[model samples]
Target: MKKSSQPSLLNNSEQKAALPCDHIPIRPGNFVADRIFLAKGSMTTPERVRFVERICALYPEAQLVECPDTPHNRIDLREQDNLARHQKGKHTLVFGEHKSAVRFSAEEGNACPNYWHFSPYGFCFYGCKYCYLAGTPSYWHSPAVRIFLNLEEILERIERVANQANMPTAFYLGKLQDGLALDPLTGFSGVQVPFFAQHKFARQVILTKTGQVEQLLKLDHNQHTILSWSLNPPELSERFEENVPTIAERLEAMKQCAEHGYPVRAIIMPLIPVKGWEKIYGGFVERLLESVPIQRLTLGGICIYQNAKALMEMKLGKGNNISQSLDPRSKIGDGRIRYAQPLRLEMYGHIVRTARKLRPDLELALCLEETKAWKELGIEDRMGHCNCLL
Candidate 1:
């Protein structure tokens, strides 16, 4: 199917003038909201409008509502009043808030996880059986893709921050949705990739399992944009990641991106323990290295979120052999439930060792796991945010 085309939310000056307030402080009872920057694109649909209205009704004290008409950018919610009220210990935002409130926590203080998450669109169009969004409140509704049109403003803010920091900052795109799933329809990468490339302090990393990357390859992009693809074995991709690109097709996209001078990365994440798992994953890694010039690779074992576990079981079938093999575990602060630490370390070690044997120079790291095990691997220094950094 052809991608949908909508008017650029940032292009409408009249709409910008009509927005209630650029910054509305919403404080519903004791729960204070983060400052919600008004992006013209945020009100693209009636549902989105209703969502915003409901949030406003709930919280009347969220401040810093500046409405800039940018295409797809990040709206910082940290500036809202009652910031302390929003946090019950570590969790940010109640689980069952609004459609737009996909729970996320900034790595405040300490070394920020070095991972950057930017979502222009919320939820996803592709319905992967293993998708974690299904567990969140937003997933209960039809998957209507909402593009945050104020992306340009968000980019400008990010650029400003990066300029002041003057360090290599990896901003993650596609946290709330697939980074490139809507690229063909929205043409965001065309504008965003180059923008980040121009800034020396920022590296734009997009993670996707989609093969519709022809638009990206055709662009004369700066080398700073790292095109990372999430790969699973063919069996898993076929069985779990329904309606997405095939493993071969994804690798082909990565190969094309690398060929076009874009630095490429790979993520062997949420690794499911299927039949003949080792041989399947090892072969997949070998095939990946054979196809793309992987600058860095992240190895992650399958980690499900607790809230989503039952849903995943139902979708994949509870009696299925693979589901039966998955053991129950605790949820990390990031919202993903994982296998036991020991088992995860073993799997990570195996993948890292196998990949290192093939390409000694290949940068390898782990995703959202204990740092101590990574340190023991002698590859500790290589660890950074979300395997996109090497």
Candidate 2:
């Protein structure tokens, strides 16, 4: 029923081979959609129906189903949770029409000046060992990745919310999902890039671990969007990260975004104090600063709730580096578990010292640490300049 841009005749094998080097591929992302579903309101319009059909076309052999109610309401938690830790993105799925997609974070006590975040999608598909979203009840019930079909309304809601603010505020997209992971398949960036580009008073911030920026490269963004990437060294990645692009690929993608005039930032977060971590991270910082034109670098250690820590234990054994590093005094800060103050200080200090030696003028901030930690690191004044804020 389509005229141009029909489904490709090539099969899965051919498609994988066809993908360019310098990138990693993921199912439930980047064009691999073996399972697809249409929610109650996904196909409300003929145009939307056509768009769904186009997305289905990319996965010619995928099985498509139509859900009667909400996408997660009917899913079984056992299977989805099992997959959450054992095999993420194994059988890629696409759920449609997320009704509640925007919210304001109310994090307090950790020196967090809360910000408004919105998701064009829900539930990231990448398999990271320390994924805090895995513990959330919303994602626990249905671990499938979702794409919202109500963009027009979402944008209108954003306008109303942005209008509430007297000054330009950022609506972040990486809170509940990797902002750009599904972009290669759904082409949502084409919608978001232009929307933020022309919005009256809202600026956009997005983060991802994927290396697919071909869609981003062709857009005409008027500096309204800030592109960020969550990163760890390849050594750490090999041990903890799965079903995502490599660090090299992500840096390459970041470089491309920077050259294309998108403000680029990096969050070297959940820093694991593995054996020889000092050398590994030190060498990596040198390479990162020398290679890319970064606007800012935010450093952080593992921060999560107890429920999420249980999920991490499931994926990684109880004796893992992260689990061993967790502060065991039973004193929780801001309702989230974290590395001890001294350990966090040591890890963050190493990165800060390394970065300062290379580029003293480089902008840096600590992510989700307490005020005292900031004061300890001598970056107390850079508190609100985090990844999500303006």
- lDDT by residue (1-390, candidate 2, tens digit) is 212232221222322211122222233333355567676676777756776676676677877777647463344323534545224333546556656677899887687788889887887778788998877876665666777767656666666676666457799999888898887766777766776776656789998998988878998888899998999989999889887898999999999999999999999988999999999999999989998988899998988887778878887889999999988652345777888888889999999999999999888898887888889989888889999877
lDDT of 2: 0.76
Best by lDDT: 2
**Overall lDDT per candidate, in order of appearance:** 0.60, 0.76
Q: Report the error of model 2 at residue 353, Å.
A: 0.7
Model 2, residue 119: distance off in Å is 0.8
TM-score of candidate 1 to 2 decimals: 0.70
Give all TM-scores, in the order shown: 0.70, 0.88
Model 1 bad stretches (over 4 Å)? 1-114, 140-143, 329-335, 388-390
